[model samples]
Target: MRLNPYGEDPVRLATSLTTSPPLTAEELTARCVGAGVVLEQAATADDLAEVNVFLGRWLRVVEASNPQARAALLNELLAESSAYPRLTDHAGDGWHIHYRDYGLPVARLLRALISVGTALHLTGRGMHRLSRCELTECRNPFADFSRGGQQRYCSPTCANRDAVRRHRAKRALAS
Candidate 1:
């Protein structure tokens, strides 16, 4: 069976958008396609504006202080964006389930895809799977797809930077 497209990929796309927001509709469309999303239509300026709005709300879900708060915030997105699961061959690879209505505009499609994908990801993985990078200087959001669910940084660069900082601090303290 094909890996569930409605889960990890959408969350990753959401994280990317939060990390480096696209400045134009064409740019947003490019980013989505790069992230493996099939936009139902060319992204419009409204789609660009509204996607920024949705990502702001999506960040609230990422920044929630606790699991309950996270769930509550994600649920609000779900309530606002999702619909009953429907089987789709829209991509024509094979039939699969989609958590949104087909033929939605780009922004609305993204809102649905990310929200439902997030719900699936958290439920299937763990509630703690969504988080910000641990490094103080780079607090970008990341989905913890690590098998152990122990991801603490957005990238190895951040992890290495934080480690070096800690090592230097310890050396200073010892000296």
Candidate 2:
């Protein structure tokens, strides 16, 4: 069975939802579709609620202070969401491994996908790869997909903003 390219995308998707959550099931589904997730079932308000709950739990995993803590949290999520891996080309997009059982509701599918993807990302990259932005006032979480794995901000804007703030503060102190 081929593992889906669950490296960066699922983490990024989870980050996006946590940083700026969609308000409706349609919006959430649209965002998932936009991110190239295949949705075989109709999204509903219940799905939205479920996603919110799942993301909340996911955020706990993200905020875990150390590798052991993170791993434990992730393991719990994995147990809840995913199953033994299997291969499928249900979408016809390509043959890939699925960590979830077939015919799950959209909410459950997302939980499984995100949990497994986050596991792959952290273990494949580094345990410290996922983190909140370093910007003092902007604490959005992010996935470090940078070539150097040194990404510390959720966006370039936040990085630049913090940089400018630091520069001005330094100049003022120097003056």
Candidate 3:
């Protein structure tokens, strides 16, 4: 069964793209396809440029100071990118819901998908679900799709490093 693209997956994709952005349209298309996004149109230079712009706006949503701010930023993205939800089988996989108008360019499709997916994620989960890594040195954004919803670091490596640092600090204090 196909996973819900408008849930955790797009959030994860957003975080992935934000963390290590593609340098070219081809690279962007490769990454999106790897993340299960189907690109009906050819990826172009304009698509790359547009995606860069969209990512900047998406970052604001991630970095919002409060839920109200987050909602406002996200709403702006949704307004700019998404349309009324409709069923589509553009990839011929099956009839699935799309939050964008048909036949958009690659960048527009990504913008619409990511924006609406983020909205669904924040509303369905908690507003605090999207955040940067708690480790101060690594500020990579992440979507907390954990069952417990308590993810703090972007990766286990960062989490382990922080834990080690905390342990060392506590040991030093005791000594």
Q: How well does candidate 3 score on lDDT at residue 69?
A: 98
Q: Write the residue-wise lDDT of candidate 1 on 37-122 in tens digits.
A: 88778899999999999999999999998999999999999998988988888878888888888788899899999999999999
Give me the displacement of residue 17 in model 2, in angstroms.
Answer: 0.9
Per-model lDDT: 0.92, 0.90, 0.90
Off by over 4 Å in 1: none
Candidate 2 regions exceeding 4 Å error are 1-3
On the 0 to 100 scale, the lDDT of residue 12 in model 3 is 84
TM-score of each: 0.97, 0.95, 0.96
Sorting all predicted structures by TM-score, with the top scorer first, yields 1, 3, 2
Q: How far in Å is the alpha carbon of 90 misplaced in model 1?
A: 1.5
Best by lDDT: 1
* Candidate 3 lDDT, 6-42, residue by residue in tens: 8777888889889999998889989989988887766
For candidate 2, write residues 1-175 as lDDT tens digits. 4446566788889999999999998898899998878888867999999999999999998899999999999999999999998878897867888888888888998998899999999988999998999999999999988889999898999999999999999999999
Give the top-scoring candidate (TM-score).
Answer: 1
After superposition of all CA atoms, the RMSD between model 2 and the true structure is 1.6
2 or 3: which has the higher TM-score? Answer: 3
For model 3 the local lDDT of residue 65 reads: 91
As a TM-score, model 1 comes out at: 0.97
Per model, state how many residue pairs clash.
0, 0, 0
> What's the lDDT of the predicted structure labeled candidate 1?
0.92
